[model samples]
Target: MAGGITDTGEPYSPYVGLVYMFNLIVGTGALTMPRAFATAGWVVSLALICFLACMSYMTTTFVIEAMAAANAHIRWKRRESERVINDSDSMSDYSDDEVIIRDRVDRSETRPILSVQPGVSPDHFDIVERVEMGQMASIFFNKVGVNMFYICIIVYLYGDLAIYAAAVPISLMEVACGNHSCSAGSSIKYNDTDSCWGPVKRKDAYRVFLTIFTLLLGPFTFFNAQKTKYLQIMTSLMRWIAFTMMIILALIRIGKGHGEGKPPVAELSGVPNLFGVCVYSFMCQHSLPSLVTPISDKKRMNGLVLADYVLILGFYSLLSFTAIFCFDNSLLKDMYTLNFTDNCDVIGVAFLRYFLGLFPVFTISTNFPIIAVTLRNNWKTLFYREGGTYPWVVDRVVFPLITLVPPIIVAFCTHDLEVLVGITGAYAGTGIQYIIPACLVYLSRKRLQPVFGEDMPNKHRSPFHHTFWVIFILAWAGSCLMFVTANIILTETKH
Candidate 1:
């Protein structure tokens, strides 16, 4: 043992691994997943969640095991470098000793002394068997172009909270209080040809304001680059708190009656949209860290599989079931969270607002590192300066500029939050999270065989085996394209 509790080669504590994965997998994604289920039909969506959970568990564990192997290789290399430096120093010290002895000894004795054998060969000291785990990993990932494509796919899949949808719950809250000032419903008349209802092609000012808030929040993510350690700790803490709040909310909805009878069709539709948001938002990249832990200890990775499923399904089921009673599917809006008003005491509302705001902030912060990495790769070549002197220019100027685009389009185009989330989730969600990862896993596995000389056992084979991913990839892509078409069909031209 290295010390009191250090195994020197052990994985992180099982509890910590579970906690981290729960946060990563169920984080922002949960917020909207409930509504998505309601939209897709609760029965079908529930089945899919179970299926995805299984896939995620198996895939995540495999990736972590692979990462641990690579970590072992890196440690081996570092130790070898240190030994080389130490051996050279020892040779210099021995040469000096020989010189001192030669000056003091008779010339005739030198021949006899030279015949004495050295006690040990320095080259043999601390010899470690070479393991090409790192090279194996690189070959595995690069062969299928996964290392490059994975991040892009993740980014594309993470289509989350459109600032435009922020208006939905706000409008719902206004209606609950018997106020019609910002009601999007009253402002529009449906036209069969245009296929949507809105203020005779008018702008939704309130939605625009919400969109502005979403935009303002985007750049704030960059602030995280300044303090990663603190952010991680805080993120861990906040995630738990968020999870707890969700559970409590679910419980309350379960125990209490969801209020009077059947909800409207629109509200029901919002359910699926909300569910989509939660599912997509729950996705996180923390699974990537297992790539650094030792193999012998990699079993700890399974803890996440257990934690994410239990908590995620628990949270999602409760939220969806309660939503069935309390909300009319027809009245569904984007920020259904805002609709949780009747369930709130002062403290609950405060927590709700805080959580709602905190997630966007955190999501933006988490996303910044990725966007930063991407920008650096694409733009750094253009700068051609040592240490990337103009980095601040990109961070300070270019990022904020880029951040504005999505919010602006959303502000003008979107009137209902539920509709917006559904559109984004159906298209972006399918592509980024499910489809892309499946492709990377398949391609990366092919690369691993040639390099590692073996296949990673799939105790948990993807439901359809390798071919299933191909089917899934195409399915998700088709869904995304279809949703985009729906958006075009439903949209009304602004004159």
Candidate 2:
């Protein structure tokens, strides 16, 4: 799911598409980016994030082009089947006016296919039907490849569920135990074993909240979430308000000469986590179909993508710069919202502080069920067999249990959001963000030559049409995986 929400598939304008993309790209991942930015230093963070934003945008276009190619593949399959059936009936050739422009064909395969007919544009590969990543994988990838795609995506979704599972309880624990006085500095923090209620430690309080949170939101995993429109609306509104309030308050504090932070220019030790956070933050490729397919006009889609990325980069820079400067670096919380909850000097009103504390609680709670259901559905799809159905208990109970249990258990083991987001994004996120798209687009282009000839131009072909871009993405993904693994090993050895 994109930013923990999927598109509704209703026809919408390009501008509307832009807003949805914006929402999809900015989620819990963005909330954690500031701390990573502060850790890695502003200078390194800014430069790397910009380069990543560009790379993410390029792969996003690759996904779009691959979607069109997937459509083409499906179309070719239907045509092949029709050709078989028609051969038995009469020698009638199937002809249509929807001809595509082709440059050249193989010497032996000079058939007017699509034979350069006039007055018809290249409408063969337009993304009308919504072929999701899984379906596209099936169409384009081998059996092993399909399973690999499912595995990568399923792992990423599990990571998402675990992050959310920990985030809400962590928020509740903070608000419940944090100091409420007019604290002058944002440096005040707490350890997990610190007392919250009498005899009840903060870690225990977190588990209590976690249990309550699971009981409340866990049921939605078994069924579809059709009635969350209003909840989503409220969540979206509150999310924007909370983010805006945090940014503004940080700016106000800095302006009042109370800014206590002085982040270093660069820190190489933090770069691995920063890479993961940024990769995670810009993760919308998996849900591109849900967002891009609904747009009524797609001619200007590349422009929309460019503009959206620009805006997001600016938003990330402003939010992170303000926070890193306004608060001491060591006191910054993994969940950035936790930083403002008890900072009475920054948010003087008690009620506002509580709201900020619980802001993630409300918004993330809405997203949890949605993501859990998505993961559950993916589980079903991965184990699914042709013409076979699961028994009632298995369908209703087993799938959901498998989906919900691992992440909750992982959360129980550790609530370190940085580590969770870092590991998830670096490995699985690399696969989803870079490797899969690169492979899909490359294979899709190769698949096209057999059916439509080599010179056929997909109207939605990416500007980076050379094989070099795809090779570059694959190489980068491989290098990233190795580097992150080595970094983790070295860090652990040191610890």
Candidate 3:
């Protein structure tokens, strides 16, 4: 169980693993961050983003350590099975419970004090297998806890898919509508009812683009998303290009002394949304097993992870600062790239303007299918039965349809990226990022203490290995949850 050899992907160097994590972290959430920061104010936004980044990194470490503990527990189970198989005279006669009781007593008594520190064997307990978060939940959590885990991740992935779904069409609609088309510069903000093509409204154009997006990328859900290897590379290149362009364009504007932005020192009213966006931006916890387990060498794994966090934090800061300072708070687009596309004063090159205008389409289109497939697989995992396979139709059709349709409907109803990202991140994002990892680490440590002994150490242990961190994370998640919920209620009441 410690051995993650079940995964078929080739092992890569830790540096490559770090890069993949970087790519994963700096995705859709980052695109919407400038607006969030602008609304939240630079001073408060900077402080909160920094705190969230550190908290996110801490939780990320907790997740890695939990994965190691999960693998260790599997190894223990296997060894226990082997012991029962070989020691038939002592184990065969009694019931399973009685056997466990006797086995624990006998093993504890015979084991040497120093050797009882943790492992049945240190080598055997390595985290070789890539146990996904869901798999780890099944292994360590009780029936209710496992069910809750699946529910949280499923909802988060659905929110992710919806954001990806809405973003592409919104980008396309902006480029298509006469009001926003990058063929010329316009500072005027248009309503959804504004004309796109003659009689068609911008909202209609959005729906049409959504349909095209669904048709173009939706079928990848029926197959393995890993087949998009080439596409992933292409989109990644485009991401760097877009980010660099945005940053450079912003810096150039700021340097010219034409910058219009003057964000307040602090704005408490905006903190709820800001918190959500920050939490969402830093979300890579769920996919850690895939990224971390593939590393060929992990001696400096923790350091590599820390460096990645620092770099990402700095990049996010640069991007947000340039954006908020380069454009006025009211003028900053929800998708920061749109600001360039919509303003000739900022970026006059027609080709670059079009690219910035439609960049979300390029990035989100490639990602939608992968996310859909992940959500589908999670659905399957939730309902999976022992020794039973899903029906052909259910596996191939039902799950994919369920995964694809909801998000499409969501995009149809609302193309507001800020609201979508904010609500999703504040709720489901909190679960996957903060609450779950803390619970996993706490439960995993407790689970291992009996078999491995209290003194046993997980080489993959996090810097925040103390019980207080776990409690603090839980408290943080609870507070964030309440804060967002209360904000929602108040906003709705005022409206």
| Residue pairs in candidate 2 whose N, alpha carbon or C atoms collide under 3 angstroms | 112-115
Off by over 4 Å in 1: 1-11, 65-258, 261-279, 285-287, 290-296, 342-396, 415-420, 423-428, 455-495
TM-score of 3: 0.92
lDDT for residue 437 in candidate 2, whole number 0-100: 95
Prediction 1 TM-score vs. true: 0.58
CA lDDT of every candidate: 0.45, 0.87, 0.85
Tens-place lDDT per residue, model 1, 1-495, is 000112233445556555656555654345455456556666666666676555444445444433334333344456668877875666576677775675467454625211213453222111122222223334345544433443343333223334323443244223323212232321122221231124321133344444555555555534433436577687777666655665565456546753422433343333345435644554443234432232323333455455656776676666555555545554433444434433342124444645543444454445444443333332333233445455687756675455444444554454454455555555555544455455445654564344333533333233344555456556755764665565456554431
TM-score of 2: 0.93
Best by TM-score: 2
Task: Give all TM-scores, in the order shown.
Answer: 0.58, 0.93, 0.92
User: By lDDT, who's the top model here?
Assistant: 2
- Model 3 accuracy (lDDT, Cα): 0.85
Error of 2 at 187 (Å): 4.1
**Model 3 error, position 324 (Å):** 1.0
lDDT of 2: 0.87
The alpha-carbon lDDT assigned to residue 397 of candidate 1 equals 67
Candidate structures ordered by TM-score, highest first: 2, 3, 1
Error of 3 at 129 (Å): 1.5
